[model samples]
Target: MRHHSTQIPESSKLSWMLLPTKKNTDTVQSTTDVLIKAGYIHQSQSGIYTLMPLAQRVVTKITQIITEEMERVGGQRMSMPSLLGPEAWKKTGRLESTGSELFTLTDRKGAQHILAPTHEEEVTSIVKSMVRSYRQYPLRLFQVTRKFRDETRPRAGLLRAREFIMKDMYSFDIDQQSAISTFHAVEQAYRACFDRLGVPYVVAEADSGNIGGELSKEFHFVSAAGEDTVLTCKCGYAANEERARGRGASGADMYEVEGSEQRVVVPAMRRPNLLKIKQAWPDCGELTLEHRKSGEEVASLGQMIALDEVCADGDYLVDAAVDGLAVEGIDNFSNVEVGDWHTAQSGDACCKCSTGTLESQTAIEVGHIFYLGDKYSKALDLLVQHDGKRQPVQMGCYGIGVSRVLQAAAECSSSSRGLRWPVSIAPYLATLVPLENNMEHATSVFATLSNICVNGARVFANNVIVDDRSYLSPGFKLHDAQLLGIPITVVLGQKFKQSGHVEVQLRVPRLEIATCVAGVDVTGDGYEYKAFVHVDQLAEFLVCALEGQF
Candidate 1:
């Protein structure tokens, strides 16, 4: 037998009242079911999802934007196979270097195959065989296709996925100067793309990593869900996590090591704390510790620690070549951290801001462009004859993570209640509904709104759905309307019948709502009164509102 009690503490009673109870559980469940039925989208794996109709429509529009931008940049588009041959990757050494990261298999005839993580080797191979001459000094080519990475740990919805879409591009130039220009050109094109999408981003120094390049830059869109960390400064200095260099003052040389200076040998005490040694021997002044591991012929002071400190078990001996008495230790060459004297300050000069100091911020990279130079062309024998001299074609690569943008947008703008999409990416601009079961009033209002939609007004972009289904309760319809987050909603029912006008509700204001009552006058031919502010006016308002926001 079980007994239950409804007991509440005096102090907790008020807070409990504010808590959401189980009474709304059924409503939430019903909403989820409706969303699934409407085919918004469904996650099959941790980060992989199947886009339903509603989601598909949004993504299709985004893809169209990307296509337009790529074309505008003079990028010649093409499609490559999702599956690729292993021979090209093997020749580049990535087949084994990338190891299990490369998804590989054997065909029926036992021919090696690999799902490409990137297309550099393949594109270079094709160019090697097709191009011949310096005349084709510069070339820009691209493709929007599906790529597989088999990420070790995929999470964060579409922000990190095993299979995703990417716009990978390759550029070729005759020389280093031309390659640098091509890189800048691609960077500009990427900026235009994100601008059109209405997402804020920053370009920062980045490491090419295993991608194999001398220089690289990443475009990071500010969002919490972003996986990469960015170090930013008021001086307009931004850099990727791997390439982040904390601003610091190069400290003065603590100790000078003259070739002939002699210090007593201490074999049992092989490691001496440079800082402590200098502190104990104040007359010796600052300490200059050598980092033997740096492999440089000249020994430079890498770091300094407290003097008189005994060596730990982990510490190792680096016999100071100067006198052999001042032994160095493993702990001397550690990385610098924040609060160091060398860190960048607010007043530092910004390359972008000119005289303005740099400011630091966090952001996620959504796109990147790399100029490959002739790394691939040289490997694959890709060459062109120009003036009777065969030369390798310069190449560059560009990438945009399509799925990541959606998650980034969601991360950047959303509240506990629901998501507030940007105007350019909102699922729909308006939802039309009648407040109560007044069929005549509701029907008449529908006709009026339909005309506004047909006129290509800004209130709706062909995605409006009128809930004329009479069986549904007004409460349920209202709940759906809110969940959809439509910018505007119109209610025509019993309330309007007495008032003799339709009610227009604008959901544009943040956490607040406003309504305007517009008179409804039906004519003899069944024509309703035209709105004082026509659909064109509504369109203009929407455009202006969105323009100011993004």
Candidate 2:
């Protein structure tokens, strides 16, 4: 995409009104702000955005990467209806379970419908009708499409938006063992996908929220504007705050459930983790938990109590702990053990590693994978005959936030002047910036580099941008390159006008590429560097640089 051919921002439209004097500062709330300031995206509403051409290029590249990874794991791409009937979600009990976060509508026929948030329910119903025997086990289906979440307060641009692009894959296996294997296979694919982005990320144990699952993990990009809190220890133990454990949180014994009608009053407000009781007993609708912030003494070890002694008189705690807690088929609150109830914090001692201190950081959740064991399949009655018996199919779902990832990558690489995008997802591989009077010479170089290919991938042409906007000053063009976070930049100015050598600047580090060019002149002042390569040697230099031959 050529800067001159860009017609949306005419005249002072390129004005850096929102450009912060510093990068990643409080002035810049998120990459969304930077993208908007740089004309890469435009805010259409509170949580909705219109991706400009530059943003589209980045998203397209991200989507392509996701597609490759999904396919590598035998995923077949398919599209499901964006507007879905409420019946499937209802059958799975997610209709009311989803609550306000769901976007629902009443058609002219008075039928309720919802915009797709995730495809679990829809895909399960489809597989239920289509596949019957175990012969079709290990099937994988995926799609890259827009999704809606009606966020109460969308923030950080694409990071938490009402409308977004997501790549969701659903897998079906004949049994739990097969499903676990398939989950790991897709996990590696997710790892590959993030690794290719060239951005730093972390995989953490996570709790499956509304998405019912037996196992879950999250892939996150650490960022200031990120919404999720992740705790990591140097020893490689990591988990979302909700699921993280700390040595301080001791596993304590609690009264066992006796009669099905006994009700235990837990301090819902003081301990958020205990509220997951709803999930602990999903099948028993009678097990209701009211969320309320209670006193610190609510359920501390100091408040231990006996189940038979539990009182119905609303005196929440007795004998220093829980007295009456009852749920059908649930023998105890053993699931909320010591460490499980504690949300790991910045200074907590890592319980798993025992040697490392857990450090807390905020991160954007770019991808999530869940192992659904007989949840959706059982709810939708998707069964398969195996060993001469019909059994519920095991399933897994994997998702990568395509748009959020674009924002996250930029946010992760943000710098003082601008943000350095990973080479794989940058809008352009490199930008050729020419001073006002050097368009002709820069165009010649651009044309030449446009045809160069390296490592089986074309590094130029569509992947590169030439700032030929003659109306802008050379200084403005150069600054724009830095603002857009172009991984590599080539400048043809007075140096090129007099001599045949051009300047190359890397966005992230201050380094010299003199090795790529014969008779290369290199100079640097610590934070910035310039490598002058003759016009004749520029192509070879870039090919080697792009190929990582350096």
Candidate 3:
């Protein structure tokens, strides 16, 4: 029952009636259009936007959810400077690795600064100075603030914005095992936050890109407009294509090839590296090889056999690690079986289980968690004493794109009718509209509903809106409410004046309305209803409906 005052006050010089007067564009027709038309956000540039009153309300609710989850996991909230010096990035070598992606500028004194896309370097530096002993082994710090990224192509409104809000957290542990435990704790917290948001998301193994780490996982919201390709197997194996791997054949599938010896060269020898080889040699055919002996080099196969004796007593080159091949006496060596070594395709065999097959889908990356190990700590010399010896601290980082969640939620819940937000995150739980002839009755109804309480919390006052603009028709107001995605709409129309029954439109589907109000005629779609209730009964019904009591 935490109470937060509404941003917009009654006497304030702001009103939803002025939304129609704002500038809008019809060129882009998506949920972003509905947001703009509804006056939630205004685009300042290609990827930058100004959050209007309505949009701010939604963002606030989202921030609150993240904050609650973070606090539950003992994450101490703090704020770091957005403008960072080049010293820390240089020490970590990210200044060169990040290249153009790191926005850089020269200060008046000729010192370089970067608009931090992330706070890894800064957080490590801060913890380095503060933590010196193993007593502070598992330290977790988090911040919910704006971040700047130099996106090559910024599009889809807030989904790929240049300036956005993010919840970034850093964890420090005394050892790798403790760091892994901390990582799982943060992962659970993220799951709770996403569940409260009510968005369909998947956690998949991911490549630790510029943010160097040993293991990485991304939380992706499944949507058609997503940018990342996620591969999932029925056997419960999931990973981003960048880090996906296929199941290699076991000893039972090994066979001998009777032909001239051909050399196969794969640049990298890591799990993800095989996928890269496949991309470079798409035309190369697959080769089934026996498992290699201990300490055997994949590159030594070319030296072991001659051209005539192809059937050698050695492992086959299903995948190999060689730079290039040149036969000693032959003019050309073209009989090699060079297949894809790097990428796992959509139909690749599931590495985890035999019965499952791999499938791919596009998804929006809403959050990422990385087991950083000692990459940053060692680079920055963030040592903590343990057992009378100083060692680099194990670290982990977790991030959630706060602004991207807003766009993703809209994409997930949008429909031909309008945008419908979840009750927990909607800007307003409901909109109260008074028909032109029923203004007096609507005023009394608004007061009664606003004073309603659910679990010691006021249900409406700041959470409900009264569309009392007399100049607009009831139909237009209703349309506007639907467009804005308000969960419920209480209309004091002809039905209320004639039969003392109000029409409550439930924009969200699968909600229990009948259980809240007895004998209420709910529509087949579970979206519209006619409820006959006295003033006191009306308050009770709204409390139950908004609180999801059914």
Candidate 4:
């Protein structure tokens, strides 16, 4: 078995590519190109990746965001073993419930063990043994490490896979209110982490798969291709399939077709067909309906539009002039589509800005945070002594899709040429390519670029590749740079050799590039070549440019 080195060089490049003596050299090179060019994931074996320097750096950066937010939101870090004793899982009935998802094995002692798909049982058992009082009422613990799941289909790159990194955090509270508070804190942290990652996301209601819980939510970056479908309401409510609500029951009262108003129905419609209903009653005042079965009533009218005037009053319902008026109840809340009016529209509550409409886009769900009531604690009998009585502790769990994030980055940032990475997630900040075989000039240019990169690195944000092969051509190098998606590339060629400056290209464009060199140079080449910038400055420039686009 061949094991690749896990040591990340300070220079952040692979010292050597590992290959079995039997594998063809050309095949290995091809594989390397496919992995590096597509993004910064290099396979060390058939199923494992080496996480080339650039990819590794992005992973680390993402992890830092997770850590910072977790800490800020009251999650204490704890390192749980990748290999957990099967007995602990069996204690919670998970060994029987999650059979195949668990990676089971036997040690030399013939004792059974299972890789932890999650740490709920382990964390609960530990807390049960250590805590026996109310003082430790709201305890939160977490771990950032690799997790294993025997996935059935590992496709769409790392979006779904067998083994990957994860940050799982567990919280314990004596009361439901405290546990809910802790849960909201972690949820806020998750939002912050995604924000830092430069990805747009929403806290959608999600099913607690395997991890049985009452009130659970998934933080989804909505995408058409995303695995989980999130349904959001124009009223600012959003949830995954597990927690999404359908159209509820509206009152039996009919409305005038010619009037205008928006009404809130109790037991909201699951599959609201506004168009179908609108066609039925085109002039009805904004109406509210309720499901007869649910028996839930509206507490207060949220927002109502009476014709052209926007009013916040609830008692004003004009008499309907149409005899065919009827209230409908829908039962399917599957997913939100591009044109779904059931979803939040413009002028709705914004997650960040107050002015913009509540827009929805696609994003892969790489992580989730949930507040698990005593569902597991009561099931597993992991109770603690508090206030002279033993009671089940409220729990919460937070997870980060260590591997899915990598794939999401690729999916969002790739272009026709190849996978261009955001500098924040790029394996290398920049790739130094010398266009021709002018060894002397290439070496000199490499040194100059290396010096600038080192300066950036000192500030905790810089990377570069010094081209030493001296074999590839300018066009080839340019193609490879675009393919790799590095934010910046420095070209050293016959032209650069003739002048003191290098032709720096920014892989990711920004307004600053256009502004910095605005009116500086222009030629009617039929293509809008905006500006010139140094490779070292590209990362910072792009960072500033893309601050809010996500």
lDDT of each: 0.55, 0.72, 0.72, 0.56
Candidate 1 per-residue lDDT, tens place, 412-449, comes to 65433444445455555555676655544544444344
TM-score of 4: 0.68
Q: Rank the candidates by lDDT, best first.
A: 3, 2, 4, 1
**Which ranges of candidate 2 are over 4 A from the true structure?**
1-29, 249-272, 275-339, 509-528, 544-550
lDDT of 4 at 420: 52
TM-score: model 1 vs. ground truth: 0.67
Query: Which scores greater on TM-score, model 3 or model 4?
Result: 3
TM-score of each: 0.67, 0.81, 0.81, 0.68
User: By summed lDDT, which 10 consecutive residues of candidate 1 come out lowest?
Assistant: 521-530
Alpha carbon lDDT at 89, candidate 4? 71
Per-residue alpha-carbon lDDT of candidate 3 for residues 1-550, written as tens digits (9 for 90 to 100): 2212243335221243346653333554787777777777889998899888877889999999999999999999999999999998999999998988778899899988999899999999999888766887689999989999888998899998899999999999998899999999999999999888877788999978789788889999888889899999987799998877664332111212224222332222323243343344444344434233221332344432112111111343222222222212222233334343345668767877888888998999999999999999999999988878889999999999988898888888777677878777888777878784886676577667667777787756677787766666667777787788888788888767777777777776446555656765456365444454555467767666656521
Q: How far is candidate 2 from the true structure (C-alpha RMSD, Å)?
A: 7.5
Give the runs in model 3 whose Cα sits over 4 Å from its true position: 1-18, 22-28, 247-342, 459-461, 509-516, 524-536, 543-550
lDDT of 3: 0.72
Per-residue lDDT over 206-248 for candidate 2, one digit per residue giving the tens place of the 0 to 100 score: 9888897989999999888688999999999999988876644
Q: Where's the lowest-lDDT run of ten residues in candidate 3? A: 304-313
Candidate 4: where is the Cα deviation over 4 Å?
1-39, 42-54, 233-235, 246-363, 436-462, 509-513, 517-530, 533-550
